[model samples]
Target: MYRLSGVVKRYRRGRATIDALAGVDLTIEDGDQLVIKGPTGGGKSTLLQMLGGLDRPTSGTVELDGTDLARLSEAKLTRVRAATVGFVFQNFNLIPTLNAQENVEAALVPLGTRAAERRRRAAEALESVGLAERRAHLPSELSGGQQQRVAIARALVKQPKVLLADEPTGNLDENMRDEIVGLLEKMWREHGLTYVVVTHDTAIARRASRVATIRKGHVKVAEN
Candidate 1:
């Protein structure tokens, strides 16, 4: 579903330039569950942004489903992002003011979904994530695990083919982390979704179909 070749992403840090990704070459097949493990300052998150079309590579190609993202217009890229990808963040990124259902429905707004359909899809998404009963609850009223579930529902409510999760379990306890991992695996199986997860959690990496460790803007399989 994704192919990247000699991709480089550099940033101008005042007088110095920093290379976040240096000639990254990667391929992710449909239904591949990939975990990217790397130390701080490595390019794991930047790689995810490239794969999900959230950021353009400074040079080389990032192609998704045969289309080159680097060549797309910003409006075109926004359309592709809304249509093909879902994102889950470590911080949960939910609206504290909105209830769980509302938060999920907000993801559909960009797609211009009808209000009735949005509500229905949001409800179903929450149910799929096992948070249907908590739909009316505010973020502050829920546990950490429940809040993450709400975030997952929001991501999936778009029915994206690829899920880009950035440390989805980072804020949870061990048990909660396990729960989230199980939920992600189950979702991957049930939905035939491709997962690209950036995580420092070794347990999460172990559960992935493949693991790549990034260091100093390069990536390598941990094993030969």
Candidate 2:
């Protein structure tokens, strides 16, 4: 679960100060599914970064399970991210040289998982994502959808408590988009993950129990 209060993220752009998150107050419960929608420069992704402990806020607090991420040391934050959160991105962010299985195993490396256990877990993750047959394929060798599935496998291989996806289906066609979204939903249910996604697709928004619209560093949440 996440509880963000008075979260403010400010960046310096030349002489001007840009507030990516002016003051965000939000709560996400365990097993909750939330979709964040907003304009290009809005604070959606910034907020996601806060939740995932990928960035520190300029002011206020971002708490996950009662631990304030903003207060953690970099070493502790890295450990929390490695053990608690999973990320999927629009670009897939796979290493072109690494095969599907290797990319998934890479996630476990941060935890100092042994090679044999890493291989077994990565294979099971790829199988769960319907990519077992493509384990040996590199990112360049797979279709866009397949590549994204590999990304999903990599994210979930560690059995993270929360899944944060930013524009996960953005690069796919309509059919493929639907497939990926469906797969995400299935994984959320089966894994009991607290899912938060930033997306522009209205179809994906419609499926969420709650939708948040963020603009100009402000956020407004609505129930379905």
Candidate 3:
């Protein structure tokens, strides 16, 4: 579902230019589960951003479903991100003031989903993540695992075609990490999502059908 060709992302740091992604070429098929592993400062997250349309490449193309994201106008790109991509991050990225349910509903706001429908979908999404009972809880009131579940719920509430997770289990303990990873896998299967995760955990990498190791803006893929 994703075709990235000659993708290059460069950032200027003072007088020197840094290449976060240097002429990378990758393909991610529909309903595929991929895990990206790399050290810090590698191009893993930058590549994820390209896939999610959160950032544009300095050169080359990032195509999703035949449309090049790099070529879209900002308005069209925003609509694509709202309607097609879902994101989960290492830190739960929840608003402390919003309750679990509200956090999930916030995702639908960008799509202009009406309030009543948003509530229904958010409720179902939370239920799917096993957070139905904690709907009223604030991020500060929930455990780390529970907070991450809320984040996952928020990401999936819109029923996006692709799920992009960056370091999703990084902050959790071993047991919690397993639980979260299992939850992600379950969601991927049930939702038929094209899942791409960036993680450092070898255990998570071992579970994937394909693993990609990226370093110094270069990427190498291997079958698990």
Identify the superior model by TM-score, candidate 1 or candidate 3: 3
Error of 3 at 169 (Å): 0.8
Candidate 1's TM-score: 0.97
In candidate 2, which residue pairs clash? Answer: none
Candidate 3 global lDDT? 0.96
List TM-score per model, in order. Answer: 0.97, 0.98, 0.98
Kindly list the per-residue Cα lDDT of model 1 for residues 36-141, writing each as its tens digit: 9999889999999998888999999999999999999999999989988999999999999999999999999999999999999999999999988999999999
Cα deviation of 87, candidate 3, in Å: 0.3
Clash pairs of candidate 3?
none
Q: Compose the digit string of candidate 3's lDDT tens values, residues 1-224.
A: 89999999999999999999999999999999999999999989999999999999999999999999999999999999999999999998999999999999999999999999999999999999999999999999999999999999999999999999999999999999999999999999999999999998899999999999999999999999
Model 2 spans with C-alpha error above 4 angstroms: none
